[model samples]
Target: MNFTHPSIRAQIVSILTAWGMPKHLTDITAEIMVETDLMGVDSHGISMLMAYEEMLKLGQLRIAGEPRVVRDFAATALVDGADGLGHPAAAMGMRVAIEKARQFGIGAVGVVNSHHFGAAGYYARMASSAGLIGLVTSSTRGILMVPTRAAEPVLGTNPIAFAAPAGPGHKPVVLDMATTTVAGNKVKVYHLNDKTLPEGWVQDEGGRPVTDSRVAMDYVFKKKEGGITPVGGPEHLGGHKGYGLALMAHILGGTMVGASFSPIRNRTQKPDDPNNIGHFMMAIDPRAYRDMEEYTTDLDAVIDVLHGAAPADPAKPVLLPGEPEEMMREKRLAHGIPMPQSLIDHVRAIAGRAGVAYELKET
Candidate 1:
């Protein structure tokens, strides 16, 4: 079923507010999540509410919590999420970083005690929209990644994102990706669609590839056994690079912010304990290096050249990092966003539990 973005956003806001989430926070969360859906990232959009609902019921996500700035410097700062939803905290972090960058040419902000924030690119785009460069990273709650040459999983997907202003006549250059071969939530997307997993996205206890989506989802989310691989398939395919990148994200988002590492936290905390996830947001002002006009003009030239390049398939044009998402947003805005019946049903169940009216009408 296809639903309009406004309908999805309204349902999200209603359910979140009904669940006792602050209206302000729900507004921010709804905007980010619906934008994610518009950008065609099905795994991070409304689909994530299922996990959030479970977290809330288990006492892991606090609806009344608010973000507080804990530490501050001229160009750097830290925020405590107060064991709350990550959206508000992350949005604040990016906004703070953007302000600091405007003043100091660069800014770095970190958030601790946060729960799952949706697409990292949303925060990055906040900076880019302000005519600055942005970078974002976050430590994930689930231990879903099997590091290179590891027998069992040790790391989470640990996503990273970067965005830079593309100036006029071009979209921002944005790149958002999980360090793992595929994000763990993508398994849920496949399960919802009743689709099989592509090889190398997951592996079995014996380290062999698993393509059965149901089995893969069970291992990654439920059983928590042999799981997803690093960005590259394995050691032979340069997966070690991805493993190292995940740690880099962990270092900045988790270790730097003093957030709990899920592997270690699982051993020490109860199942319902707060995930204590962390986020890293940074922004750089191009004006610090050169005039905005010069920077943007050069960037536009580079993008133009890239777009002008010959395509391997003539039917498909050469596209930049964020063009596909922009295209998707345009398409979804014109038509309605597609929602699987299963996802719609699940969300309706959550709304029922929250005592909110189900308002996701088919478009």
Candidate 2:
């Protein structure tokens, strides 16, 4: 079913409020979720409602908590999220970074003890919108992936994002991606759709390839046996590159924030046990290099050339990292966001329990 952004945001806010979230935090959470849907990242959008509801029920998230600054330097700061929703904490961090970047040539912020912060690109885009280059990375809970030549799970599906301004009438060059072949959320989406996974995406507990999404999710989430693989599948295929990147993110994010690493932290069972998931963000002023306008113009020219590059496959032309997502965002914004039938039903159930009215737009 399709739902207007405002409607979806309102529904989410109402549901969260009913679930005992503070009014202000509920608004922030709803806004972030709705924005994810608006950006066509359905996996991180309203589909996460059930997960948030479960977290709230378990008291893993405190509705009224605010983030606190633990340490500060001229161009850097560390924030303790205080177990608050990741969106608000991240937003505040980016804002602080932007302010510092304006004064200095660059600014960096590290955050810890926050919940899942929707899409990393959103935070990067925030920096780009402020006329600065933005970079972000985060370490997630123990939904580890199968390492090369390894049978069991080890590392989390860490993600990295970068965003920079382009030119007039052009979207920023925003790249956000998981280090793994496929994110756990994508596997969760497939499971929700009653579909199987591809062979390359996961492995069994014994290190054998598996195509069953249920088994994959079960192994990673329940048994802690197997996990999703890195981008290159195995070590022979340069999977070590992805592993290296994941480790880099873990160090910059987790270690810097004083959080436990994936192998040591157990967040699946104890969601509120201060898993200390960490995030890092940096913003750089474009004027530091050259004239801002000329820099963006050159960036646009390069992107245009790449977009027009000769295609290896006629059916699948070259694409910029953010182009596909930008197209999806535009299309969804015009037609309203689509939700799975089961998700719609779940939302309705929540609304019913909360005494809030529910509406689904016609297809």
Candidate 3:
């Protein structure tokens, strides 16, 4: 089924407002979700409504709360998310960092007490839109991945993203990826899409590989056992690098931000207690380093050369880091966004539970 972006966003806003989320926050959340869907990141799109709804019901997520600044500095700061949805806090942090970067060469913001914040690239793109380099990363609460040489899941699928503004006629260079071989939520997307999971993407609780998407979803979300593998499958293939990256994200987003780790904190069982996830955002101003025009012109040359390179397959053109997503966004904007019937059903279920109107059309 294909749905108009405006229609989806409107329904989301209505549902969120009815569920007690402030109007401004709901608008932000809806924009992020719709933008994510337009970029073809189905895992972070409307499909996540169910998870957010569940988090709200459990009282782990809230709205209309102000983020408390824990540390204030010129180029660096930390903010407590006030146990709310991660979108608003992360977005605000990026804005603050951009403000600082306008004067300073770089700025960084750390956020704690946040919940899942959809796609990290969204925040990075925010900085890129402001003509600055951007970095966004987040750490989750529970053990969600099997580390190298480990028999059990002991790390979250910590994610990292970076975006840099490009010169005229070029799209920003945006890269977003999970430390794990694949993001856990992607398994849910695959299941709903009726697609098969590839090998080495997931493992059983006891460290065995599993290729079925449905089974992987159960292991990760149901807390049954083993979960995602590191960026590399096993020790020989560079799984250690992925494991190290996960820890690096945990250190910045989890440790430095004062968020609770799955292995360290047990405050999640009760309703109203926060999951205490954390996020990190950094922005860099190109003009602070050199002349902005010169830097951008050089970047455009680099993109030109990249595009001129010979393709391994003539039918498929070589693409830059963010080109595919840009193409997807363009395509989606013209033709309506595609939604799996299963996802539409799930979104309707969320609306039903919230007692809000579902104003969507499927064809």
Candidate 4:
């Protein structure tokens, strides 16, 4: 199925409104979700709506509360999400970071008591749009990563995102990645689409890699015995680097914000326990280091050399960090966003349940 981006965003906003989220928050969240899909990130886009809504139903996400700043300083602050959706909290945090950087040249915000904030790059892009460098990371209550050689799971996917401006006449450079072979939620996406699992993505209880997506998904999300491997593959494949990055994300995103580590959270525990996820967002003004013209020219030159470099295959050109997504956005906007029939069905089911009209038109 295919649908225009605007149509998808509107439907999402309507359903979220029906679900009791404020219009302002839902509007922001809807744009982020649509932008994620526009970038061809099926694993993190509208495919996630039902799961987030479930968080609200289960009381893990506050349905009626708004995010509020709990503490403030010169260029750093703490934002209490009031146990609400992470989108609004994270967006607010980035906005504040941008504001602070305008004054102090650097700013950081920690958002606590929040739920999933879709697409970390969105917040980073916010800073880039303001002509500043940005960095963002988040903690998760769910755990699915296996250490270098350990069979047990201890860390969450824990993404890291950074973005920098190229000044005028060029796009920003943004990089966002999970510190695992794949994000934990992505296993669910593959499972829903009945796709085959890529090798080196998941591991069994004894640290043996699992190649069956369904089986691997169950092991990681339900059984909780087996898990996904860290960013690199096993220890031989530089998995330790991924393990180290995940822990660093936990420290910056969770520990610094007073959220518990995955091991202590015990996400599977009874209700009334919140995921208590946290996030860190930072903005740095490049003008503080050098003149905008000097910085922009250097950055553009570097980008040109990289793009001009030879590629292994002529059909595939060397791309910058955000080039692929930017290309995808252009293509998707010209045509329409594509989705598996199963995903279309899933989203429609959610809309039906929420009593909101499904505005997508199937091809």
Candidate 5:
């Protein structure tokens, strides 16, 4: 099913509102979800509704609370998500950080007691759009990543995102990635699309790679023995570096914010207990260091140099970090976003349960 972006956003808003989410939060979340799809992050877009619906029904995701500041300092702060959806709180945290950066040259904010936020890049872009450098990271509730030489999984995907503006007439540099080799949601994407899991993506109890999509899903989400590898496939291949990066992200995003570590929390908490996820958002003003024209001109020249570099493959040119997403956004806007019929039916089922009208029209 191909749907216009606006239609997708409307359907998301309708279902969220039906589920009793406040209009303002629903609007913010819906826009983020739609933009994630437009940016070609299929794993994090509408597909996430399935997980959210389960959380909603289980009473783990609250629909009534808004984000509130818990602590504030000169250039750093802590935000409470009020045990609600992560989108609004994450958005608020970035906004606050941006404002602080304008005053102090650098700002950092942490969000706690939040549920799964959509693509981190969306929040990073928010800072970039305001002409500041943005850095983002989050701790996950699922224990899907296995550390190097570990027999079982202990870490979540633990994504890290960074974005920086290139002044005018140039796209910002945006890098959003999971410390693990692939995000756990990408496995769900593969399962939904009936695609095979590539080698090195998932491993079994003995650390042998699991290439079968269904088995990989079971290992990552259900059985939970050996799971997704760190960024570098194996210990000999620098997987330890990926493991280190995951810890760094968790330290800043989770521990720093006083959020529960999933592995420890799950041992005592019930199935319906809130995940207590945490997020880190930071912004830095380049103007504090140099003139805007000098910074942007140099950055643009660097980008031009890379763009002019010789490609190893003739068909694939050298592209910047955020170029692919920008290109995808343009393409999706022009052509329409495509989704599997199964996903459409799944969303419709959710709408039925939520008592919302299924009005996602095809483009």
Candidate 6:
């Protein structure tokens, strides 16, 4: 099915409001979800409505809770999300960071006890919009990532994002990605479509390769006997790079925010358990080092050079990290977001349970 951005966001807001979310929160959550779709991040978009609804039903997500200041320093702060949705909590944290950066040239915030934030890029882009360099990282419950030389799942598919201002007519230098080869959300999408996963994404219970989505998830979440591998397939292929990145995210995100780390924080053991996911955000004022315009111009020049680089395969061209996503977002926004029938049904079911009205756009 196809749905316009505004229409989809309105439906999400109304349903969340009916589920007892505050007006402000409903707005922010809806905006975040819609923006995920806008940026071609189907995994974190409206497809997550069912997960949010289930969390609310289990009382794992609080509607009226507000973040509390756990600690504060001159240009840094630690926030406890109080078991609130991550969108609002992260937004609040970034707002504080932005304000501090404006005043002191740099600011950082750490958050714990938060639910899944839609997309890391969304938060970093928020900082870029304010003309400041942005950095974001997050740690979550064990999902589909596997540790090197180990069969069982031990790490979350931790992700990091960074964004900075750019020259005129160019989008910000935004890069967002998971340390793992793929995220659990992408696995969920494959499962919904009844498709097998590509090799290297997951392994069977005994550390053998597997392609069945259902079996892969069972190994990762249920049996806990096997899991998704790091970006590099095995020990020799730079898999350690992805491992190092995941560990860095844990330290910066989980440890810094006083949340559980690695095995201790796996939420799959207790699906309804309140998530103590942690996040880190930093904002830097562009004027701190050099002229803002010159910096942006240099950034644009570098991007242009990278774009013109020769490709190993003539059929494919060299591309910058954020360029393809920028083009996809523009196309999807104009054409309408494509959603599967099952996801549409999921949203309708939620609306019915919440006593909210909804209408789907024709495909």
Clashing pairs in 1: none
Candidate order by decreasing lDDT: 1, 5, 4, 3, 6, 2
Candidate 2 on 1-363: residue-level lDDT in tens? 677887888788877777677787777778878878887777787878777766766787775668878889999998888886687778778888888899998999999888788888888988999999999988887666666677777888888889998898878898988888877787777776778888878777777777787777776564757787887876646577777778788888788877668676663547456456788989999887789989998999998899899999989988988878888878888888887777788888878877788855544
Instruction: Judge candidate 1 against the unseen true structure and give its global Cα lDDT, from 0 to 1.
Output: 0.92
Sorted on TM-score, best first, the list reads 1, 5, 4, 3, 6, 2
Candidate 3 lDDT over residue span 1-363, tens digit each: 789889989888888888888887888888998999999998988888888888787877776566767787989989888888888888888988898898788989999989888899999999999999999888986577787788887889899999999888788999988889888889899899888888888888677777787777888784687788889776656688888888999899889988888766764366667788999999999998899999999998988899899999999998988778889999988888898889889988888888987888643
The collision pairs in model 5 are none
- lDDT, candidate 2, equals 0.80
Note the residue pairs that clash in candidate 3: 205-226
lDDT of candidate model 5 versus the reference: 0.91
**Candidate achieving higher lDDT, 1 or 2:** 1
The local lDDT score (0 to 100) that residue 210 gets in candidate 4 is: 83
Q: Give residue 308's lDDT in candidate 1 (0 to 100).
A: 95
Off by over 4 Å in 5: 236-238
Q: Candidate 1 on 63-156: residue-level lDDT in tens?
A: 7799989999999999999999899999999999999999999999999999999999999999999999999999989887888778889999
Residue 287 displacement in candidate 1 (angstroms): 0.8
What's the CA RMSD for each of the models?
Answer: 1.0, 2.2, 1.6, 1.5, 1.1, 2.1
CA deviation > 4 Å runs, candidate 6: 68-70, 265-272, 312-317
lDDT of each: 0.92, 0.80, 0.86, 0.86, 0.91, 0.82
